[model samples]
Target chain A: MTTAKRDTYTPETLLTVAVRIFNERGYDGTSMEHLSRAAGISKSSIYHHVAGKEELLRRAVSRALDALFAILDEPDAGRGRAVERVEYVTRRTVGVLMAELPYVTLLLRVRGNTTTERWALERRREFDQRVADLLKAAAAEGDLRADVDTRLATRLLFGMVNSLVEWYRPQPGGGYEGEQVAEAVVRMAFDGLRSGG
Target chain B: MTTAKRDTYTPETLLTVAVRIFNERGYDGTSMEHLSRAAGISKSSIYHHVAGKEELLRRAVSRALDALFAILDEPDAGRGRAVERVEYVTRRTVGVLMAELPYVTLLLRVRGNTTTERWALERRREFDQRVADLLKAAAAEGDLRADVDTRLATRLLFGMVNSLVEWYRPQPGGGYEGEQVAEAVVRMAFDGLRSGG
Candidate 1:
């Protein structure tokens, strides 16, 4: 690679390339050599930025996990009735998934084959549990349907949110914004898809 | 291998073993040798059952697609109010996912790396479109909410239904039966998660 390109490569830039390759090829299927080739930098240059491929995986998922965990710390997520708080977190989560699509995609697909992946899985479950607790609190307040299990409801709600990674490509001309999609998710999820409620 | 084990290895049995391996180690990571080792059969024996690894993948995904597409032809799916038909299809789709978990899991995870995977993805899109049409018909009947886009609603609806593949394992004592989960899915999808709706 040219000195110009090599000089410009940073950990964040390298991570963007690495996560793309990881997502294209499964994490276990990718190699450091592949990352170097994709990033247009030497393996040594990659090592200079980080320890190895696992480090990159860790950084990428950590970015996603950090963003997700940060949502719980937001003022809206913290305040209001439990039902309102659940709605706020749900809407904010759709926004996070859309904003950090690639990183979160990689985070979601980890199969726990390695230490980094296992850690990512644990963090993901922790996030799920936090949300599940919110649903439980809502249920206790008589806002959530008592007929449905809160744990199951939590799974289905986030399931719909997480599936965006499978099909939610950003529009070319800003046709559908993240807020609009988030609104659609909240509406269908909370208000039901059928009309005449 | 024992003569008894070799004698009992039907094509159906072999597909079961192959799908397990493919899901554990992704389809790309699996080999005929891996299949042979996992199945307690020789490479020649595996070849005797199917032409190659891709053939096994094709068979596995075709089973899932066939089961899913068959839902549309059901009397319940075809003959009811548009809203009720959507609910029937949703509930039956959940039952199919639960009944055929491993096969559908493999189908959902295909990344189109091979021709078989590409074909599987195309059929998946077709299935999604069929369901979207059902949602559109329901909207025209004024049974679905007008505030949300029908196409987006269809995606979110099935997105919740399909997410079961990620986490809906059959309980050891039949704790969560297929029909029960289907009921839960239909109720949550059609009847709003919030209470007093």
Candidate 2:
């Protein structure tokens, strides 16, 4: 399908282009012109796929948020012992983030300048609170350390997880491998670097 | 020095307002007009203290970079076992981040959009590399866990440090201080939340 036929761009493909441009130019720095240029289409052509820039942002963050929130719903995440649930959420989160790298990367970088961004941030906080609750439960169950504040521990745990977007690049060779990295993160986080003899 | 005398804002005072705006609206989001409103001064008044927005950013990030780079020069940071030095830098880096929150926040948020920002990012990478070296040394000393890559550890460690900008608000009651937070960060980093036992 070329100009001869019909090569209609979907909201999904447009979003892929938009997130990359947003990451490259930043959400605020990007303009319709930038999106048009990156997408190989005219500015007017973009309105066909999505409402505007904000819609693209909303879609991108929504993907990331859904991926994150869905972690809470997973069987392993929901039915495990509190500590196991926390670890399951942690592992799947790193996997989700890596799988949905571009979308999650955009979500992590939002600054709450617009309604979409603020909504995204609120959802992020909600997600954090859910994790914090798990941590709290784990501590109460005596599965996790009671010495640390659950809130602080949750933040540091996600802090390590979310930092992946900053520097993690998927291998150019196929297969989308991530579990190895996730395993390392879990071990480094829960078990500490000190090897027990 | 009464109200009768002409009132003017010093560069230091102007920066406090400017950095807040920068952190909120982003360096690129801010305009001379935004600064004027935030500082309760005319747009022209801002020019008197600094050249323009980029100059303001350069000054702010320079201050932050200076503090971090100086950590490498400290006796405690430079001396002792590699693991100790790594811990020393982590604790002091947290303190530096908290003490110079606005400046460090500005530095962390800068993208390579302008010359000032690119320069700041380069310098930041250098600082990161220096810390990464400390992690490498600690790993070589067989102190750090061998399983996780030192580079990944360095990124996660700094990620823990840099995330302070996102949520840490200094207390109005002054009971919770930066040093206390820094201590907590160090404790959590070296020893797992599970405890020394």
Q: Output the TM-score of candidate 2.
A: 0.86
Worst 10 residues of 1 chain B by lDDT: B1-10
| Candidate 1, residue A157: lDDT | 92
Candidate of highest TM-score? 1
Residue lDDT tens for model 1, B1-197: 43224545888999999999999888988988888888888888888888999999999999999999999999999997888998898988898898899999999989898999999999999998988888899989999888869888888987899899888989888557788788877877777788886
Error of 1 at B165 (Å): 0.8
**Model 1, range A1-197, lDDT digits (tens) per residue?**
43325447888988999999999887888899888888877888889999999999999999999999999999999998898898999999999999999999999999898999999999999999999999899889999777878878888998899999988998878667898899999888887888887
Question: On residues B1-197, what C-alpha lDDT tens digit does candidate 2 reach at each position?
Answer: 11222328998888888899999888888999888887777777788889998888888898999999999999999788898898889889988888898999899888899999999999999999998898888888888776758776777788777888877888888544676677666666666655334
TM-score of model 1's chain A? 0.95
| Stretches > 4 Å off in candidate 2 | A1-7, A25-37, A42-45, A111-116, A173-177, B1-7, B40-45, B174-177, B195-197
Interface RMSD of 2: 2.6
Report lDDT (CA) for all predictions: 0.89, 0.82
Interface RMSD of each: 1.2, 2.6
Clashes of each: 0, 0
